[model samples]
Target: MEKFKTLGGSEGSTFFFSVERQKKWERLDGPIGAFVRVMPWRHFGRKNLGYLFAILHGADFFFDFDDDNYIKVDESTGKPVEILPSTTVLDNVMVAMSGPTAFNHHPMMKPSIPAPSWARGFPWEYIKDEATEGEPAFSQSIPFVSKLNSIGVIHEGATNVLVPKHAYSPYNAQASIHTQPALWATLLPTTVPGRVSDIWRSYFAQCIFADSNLRLVFSPPKIEQIRNDHDILADFAAENDLYTKSGKLIDFLSSWDSEHLHFPQRVEQLWIDLYERSYIELDDVVALQKWLEALITMGYKFPELKPRFRNVALMGQFNFADFPNSMTQIMMWSQKMRERFQTTIAAAPLNKTQLAYLETHRIDAIPARDLKLRKRDHLGFYNPLSNLMRTLLRFENSSTIEAVLYAHDDALLNLTELSEGKYPFPTDKIANRIKGELSNAAFVDLRTMPDRAKARTLSHRVFPNGTISDIDKTIFVNTSSELKKQIPSLHAKYKQWGHYYCAPGQQQMAMDPEFAMYLDPDGSAWFPFHTQSDFLIVPTKYAKPFTEAATMHLKHFIWIECAFGKIVDILQQQLQAPTRLVKLCTGFGDRRGRWDVINNHDCQSESVAVFHPFKIRGRFDEFWAHADEINFPAYSSRGKN
Candidate 1:
């Protein structure tokens, strides 16, 4: 607002943008003539012009704020209050927040009170934890993302120094900065509802910031808004777009895999996709197109939109018959992965009809053997999983495939966990996460790990008798003769330390150190890998090595989970770097952890990148109801759709 007001006699830059001076913007006969009517009368959408105003006036950076938000004055002292420091320096003491989808800073803005209102454009789906007293649903994890005070409220409070954490933080035109590089986010969609136009702009711009590693900091409220008269109901009505579509918007951005786009290009593609879904207007996208063109015409170079092309092979059993719902699930994932990667569904060719269908849908089918595990013992699941890894590791273009996402056949990955793609399985962003963080050993969920590594289980109560052996007699009793012959050395270790094998409740960090030493009497740095492998990802380069080393004449398996852990453990010794892992989804290491995913699905839906044990075969309707917030699976199968 101050930037525009200062363009008084600066005709050189003023020719392009001259908003009415201290006068009614609604007047058609104002200085800019009927052009004022082109952008709607008395609408918040006009705020986009502020960004244009900044760009035209040679401002490398400009503060984009609203008129209703006033500079907060300290009654005790007649001066501007310092809400944030005016410096950018780094040290161990300095906190850091890297690439939060949305920074819910309102709670930080007013710590004492429960900042319950939603950010103007925050997704309603995530805000499921409602205060039973007729309050709006709020996302439990990202509570502050939606706080209602930004709307016509008289704010009063001091804020704490910012805390560093990843979240969905939406800064508004209310009082936000738009530097030269950040200018692309200031676009206010002309056709957006008056109430949500600014919000739409915020999400649009934040996508670029979040992905590009742009710095977006928060501070105390430097302004007090004494908003003009407004019909509260009308404002609510205008927010319909915000309530329904924000989740999809953020979800799309979060899982956007385009494998080959960056910055404004990705931003443009997002708007295009949203427009196709009728979630947003295309004219707004064009406005952005023109803005970029104008900047380019004036010889203003945009920082290059670096290409983020990542190709990945999704290796898993994609059965559609035993699990009819698997058809729709596979289709959904293939479509989702295409958003972020050049994807290949490397499924076992066991089902010819299924392979034909996948190929017909252009879901580039890659033949990978899904050898079945005949035995039900500790090492039973090793053969088929190892066979699959060996196949994926030897991809035609293994160098091109960045990572392999392995999961249960029923796992449905998406955002917000709503139906209609309100929340689906995650793809692009998660693949990048797997690639960036995973080193030679394998990825693990380090967050839930103890500060110091020791033998532990989900519940400390599930300890075994002091010195027991062959406690897991199943190692020999259920072990098939074929598995024993293939990995006799591994068989010995499995039988020897079978007591320490992890179960639903009896998972060990690495099992007891004595047990570790027992397994590898001659090995050093014998890191016991966690057997939490209902769903997992392995870097493509390590997939073959991991599979090859799974039965390292040592460290056999308890289940497929144990195989995954042991593979990483065996291979880590040969790699140059240590391992790093992340817990992409919520549900993990619980009592009914494998059996009851739906019961806890409500709580774990939003936070995870890859959801597991979704069991679409039986829970199809249930997953749909949970995801789309609908009655059931709208289409019986992908064919029906």
Candidate 2:
């Protein structure tokens, strides 16, 4: 990108470095209007925010690298370069690659050494020349026109490098630097695997460079690969696309007739092809759209994004969304829903005026009575979730939703990595990852972490039979046998057994929903599973069965917790897929007994989390503010990747 004007003064002598957190920081204006807000909690795209940080701060040169790869120390002085060198040209000389547009610098070995090892994402086609364990003749690549902000090249950089306007070797988040001209490519892709996001960006940027005046440079070895422990097999799995599709991507780029397209259009089209081929998700393209806009706002100019294909059809249709599915739009929708719920019946469903206010916001909700739930006072089921099974069924019929994260508005969710030191946060990606896990799982019970004991204790509710006293003391309905005995003259299909009838000193009623459910039809007793009704995740395939089970239980006026939990149990026996119960959140049920403690609760002291039972907005806000007090650690892109 051509520099327009400097935001600050000239470069200073003091080295200024700052570690950025990877979460939304409320309103972001100017250049750093990062895609963080739209990014799914903590996807790899969040790291792209760092690029804006570098730009907003008026950085002339940007250093990008993984945390594990540290600068090499001078053995004699025991220092990592007493003085950081400005020049990257090694031995005051440079030699450009003549054969291939890629280079792999294994710092530990000289170029001439025949040990021959392939870099993490070197094309497999080249590596698998079985006759020669790891050697393949490469031909000249077509030239690209890009400016070069040369510091020479980073020799022995221990990463693959791309020849400008030609071919590429995967330059990773492991060790790399970008000058102003190359800074535009530093935004890592969001939708690809965290392990391969950088590699994905590398090929993309190199392709752009091939058409710009930008140039790649060389420098002496400065950093060593002190990588952290990684399961090689897992790394391979994560990089499956990189291994298999790199060559295919190259072929696509070579034949892509987009020479007339602008920079952003080219970038978008490249990702579009990848998405169309099932190489990446549409989420990445949307993110790229926002990223380019941010670059424009920052006053940096690229070739331009206007394309001939905007109005014209190419393959019978335009795949790109006319209005991109941006993060701001999503946030607005969520805010609207929350506001509607607050007025509609969430805080309290007592007033029609409030309900009318909710209708103005376009929040879709059916009345509780329509689902056969009581309007006088909501109870039992995860408050108001008697509709959960129905909603899941709807999603199943629509086939749009792949996974569901059913949670109480009160539960605090720490889906991101930095859920304060106090809140116990999740360890890995949840949304997309859970969607993937759905292939093997019928549903995953992601109840809050603190609710595990509650889930276990309530998994199976027992009814040791009951007497007349149990009628008023606990909920009960008469057995079918008793109903026939008590009210025979009534309607033929109508039977309550005998309005919760019981014998003196003789066991009669089956007290809990679990026991009641067993006698609904057959005489045999059936056991059902129980879990906190607060949170759950059900994939679309099993939604119908789950909803049917829950609806049946609810129809008999069983408690909500029983209706919600037993559906999972019913599915376990009815289907082959296992119903998994995983601790995916931070809070469980409300601690009404601990009201005194909660009044002064220090949310920062709780493990990072998305807790529930924050039914009151003011209380949730206070706790959320406390939860935000714990600082986020530095953002690292390569660790999880």
Candidate 3:
């Protein structure tokens, strides 16, 4: 440890001892701490760990050496020397890895030895002379060539090197240096005895690496293993499963189409496929899931684990006194160093253009008044338009109207009102009303009307110009049915018009042929529109057309919905256009005028809204509730619609 510390001098090297005093270990603020928190220490003992730790610590490569192993020394000089393969041998192995082929021959094999020898997990079927020796089988090299040093290349030969495409079994965990490409190679199936875990993991990793067109090199042994105090029988028992099923497992993994899946997903699917093929039990699947989840939670972004280490050159030397003895003090010093370095970086002056760009794109600087205006415009247009349409289409008079409203009763009334309305609008009353009055109605819920309308509003925001012409225009129709029919036609007529249509009750808009059709006509695209109200249209230039924006918005909405409003506001500011709220309908209950009443009602019922989803009773009751109080900020009575 002292030698390593000296050699790594101020290079940000960290060591974790397998001591009981884990709490005493400081330096938990960065990625290293995050990794230690999620490590499966209970399952794999400290002796067989650190692959994940290396990744978290941003190591370019990690060297694994067993305690039982020692570096070989020259008798004359008493100096250590790595036992590397000859150039000829490495060249032969290289030929094999260059093609789609698997080699069962061990690098330790000797031609002169008249006895048969095999690596621990080498398949018995390929143990014969022809399979083990002679001309090396070949396959096409990976189409994508990495810079010589960029990829995880294995160096073991004295003068020659080989990158084997297919990794044979018995790639021992000890005396190996794993680079970033093979970082996803995790020791899974913790229930399996420790003896075979590394072997199986290697096979699984090899299969994955091959899918990514990566090669695993088998080099000459660098260290000699000193025999440890272990019973041969016990070791054999632990390795019994590998002897029986290693080949079968390899074949099973090879069959998977990993080209289409991400590394993590591929790992998951591999375990599932294994279970489906009756190779592993359900418990194995569960264990695999836990391992994969731990990897994800530990912040392992596989296949693209880019090195993000900041190299800080040392100026002054550090003595024992400089390193704090107390863990808390050490942590504080480290944190202060980090903050100081950040401050230094932040203090660097930006050029005028960069400063201007930052100012233009700054979202926090957006005035509260502008945000309120935007919200008001959104609400004013959509609320009345949707309400008028519902009323005119006779949707409110439908037999199923009461039933629909009852289903979304929480959205209509607060908890107190819900409790009271139950007696008057019972199940029978709602059902009868639905069957009689709403039988032929569109059956659109008033609660979701805002979101539905917002979908269209978002479409307009993405493509400001009327679809048929570049000029902005607004046309109002008399009835709800006419508005619905004409909206799609109007969008179709305008070359630049795009429609943001969401299916009734959906949280967001759909990406379908119709959406594409609307986008293709005007080269307009969809942007993510989170609100249900479809009234306000901002004539602004967007970074992308409606189609691209809609696709991006859809993707973003899946991850988080709150960012939608922020993104829209950013676009509004960028376009530098007046955001107009065009009124399409009138005579619906004055939503703008009732802002105070709605705001007061919302504030009082905030708690009920939070707990309503948990207390929902009916099948669609949860969907019917307008939990916007929880989803959005309180409606301010100060904003004018």
Candidate 4:
């Protein structure tokens, strides 16, 4: 510990002892304490003690050692001994690092000592090939080297270094140095027992390292293991999965096409693919995502060795004065530049113009002080629009609306139906009764058009003689999917016709052809001008493609609200048309009073009498008795009949 602290110096090593961790670490306040608090494995007990410590400290190089491992000593002098000779060559080779290389199973006690034993996690299949009967001899011939990278492998006085097309591993964690590039590979699957975690992680790391063209050197053993107390049977049981599935897992991973994906994305995809193949359970993928998130949160950028351009420029010497002062000239010049330079030039030190360009383009490079001010200014503009949209989209039955409109009432009245005098308001009867009254009106029941045949039949009524001028006024009621397909054609023909639509709520209105007209429903009197009694006049010229797009797929409420609101803006801004509000019956059959507050409003007074006595399952008996007192104006009184 003292030597490590000295070696680390100002970098400061951290020690996480298993016993009384929280009590001991609680005293470490501020950044270090906060770091410990958020560690994913803080509550994992001692299952991942070293990994947790490594992540918390943001270690660049981590040397993992078991408690049972120690430095080898000379038996004659009883002094610590060095394993590797000074003559050992250090370099990387691809062929030597390849997948089929046999595992080194020589006993750690001494290279000259013969042993039949294999390492604990080593696969049983490789025991005969890798194990030797006598001391391992050194090769006198120098190994071939490639120019790719320096990766040296020393085992029993022999060294071979060659870059390989593929790599495999039975690497142990007892004494291993994990470099920064391979830190993501050290994430052990928490679902697996502790015994196999290191072995699996090693295999995963080898894959990652091989993909990155990084070296994995196997040197002579540096540390000797003083065997710890453990049940060999229990250890074997824990390692059972690896023995059975390690080769299969490796083969599965090797078959995947991960060359195009970024390193982090590749790692994440690997886990997901493994889960899909049922190699590892879903819990393993979840753990991988958590680890990846933690790695990103810790600000570790996945290292990409390939160099990339930091900036782009147009390098050719050309005179801008040669072209005419027109958009065509500018476009032509840009095209020629693109064709000549292929859109990018090698990055060089920034010149004055490049620096100025960067200053203008780098919006995200704002300083912290300016960022706060920008956010404050941004909210100043954003909040009011957000609040206004929220208020406009709020349903009539919303508690917030009821709270404001009926604040004085101890118990808010739940208006159940459209009412008149002490007689049951026969809304369905009035529509038939006023057929003579609405002689000039054309009523198209959009709801009845459930199929294209019915939709085409209704279309002829709305657009008589295949032209809009043939109709004086058209009313589309209860819009549905069949009606939606006919709207675009109807709207295209009826450029001047006064089209009106009525529905219960915004969701229903959203399906209608006039949704965009309700943006500033209360503020702009333009909306009310299109109103005739209960129906809101649809300006077919201004109606957007509402039902055409699948808006129900928008899962979040705010998104739907914002999207509809944006549609309203586009209509108002692009079409420059007026929108109006009108009284319409939305809750006809809502007998349970679910839509009572929305339906039973004073606004119902402005509804067209021709479509009065709105039938709602004949449920609002109380409302019908007091219907006349509700002050519903006759269509004739509004001068629209």
447: Cα error in model 2, Å: 94
RMSD of 3: 25.4
TM-score of each model, paired residue for residue: 0.45, 0.39, 0.38, 0.36
Hey, what RMSD does candidate 1 come out at?
17.7
**Local accuracy of candidate 2 as per-residue lDDT tens digits, 1-641:** 22322322226644322233332332454334445465564566555666665675566556676768778788998989522234432233222222132334332224554655656666777553222121211222212222233221232342223232334556677656676666778877777788888877877776665445344543445787777999999988989988788877766654343544567777777778778877678887777777777777767656322111111100000011113322112222223222111111122222354334333333233334343444323443332445455555555654223544554434434333322221112212112112122223213332222444333222212234532212112223333344234334322322321232112101222444444544423232232332345555566577666666665555455544334444665565457545443332233345541223332333333332333344323242243233222211122211121
> Which lDDT tens digits does candidate 3 get at residues 155-192?
33221233333334456566666666566664445546
lDDT of 2 at 157: 45
Off by over 4 Å in 4: 1-14, 17-49, 55-58, 73-122, 125-165, 305-641
The 10 consecutive residues of candidate 1 with the worst lDDT sum are 131-140
Q: Is candidate 2 or candidate 3 better by TM-score?
A: 2
- Cα lDDT tens digits, model 4, 312-411, are 1222111111223222222222222221111211111223443343233210111112233224322221222222222223322332121101000001
Task: Point to the candidate with the largest lDDT.
Answer: 1
Query: What are the runs in model 2 whose C-alpha is more than 4 Å off?
Result: 1-26, 29-34, 74-79, 82-114, 128-164, 259-261, 303-641
Q: On a 0 to 100 scale, what is the lDDT of residue 360 in model 2?
A: 39
| Best of the two (2, 4) by lDDT | 2
For model 3, what is the C-alpha lDDT against the true structure? 0.37
* Deviation in Å, model 1, residue 29 alpha carbon: 22
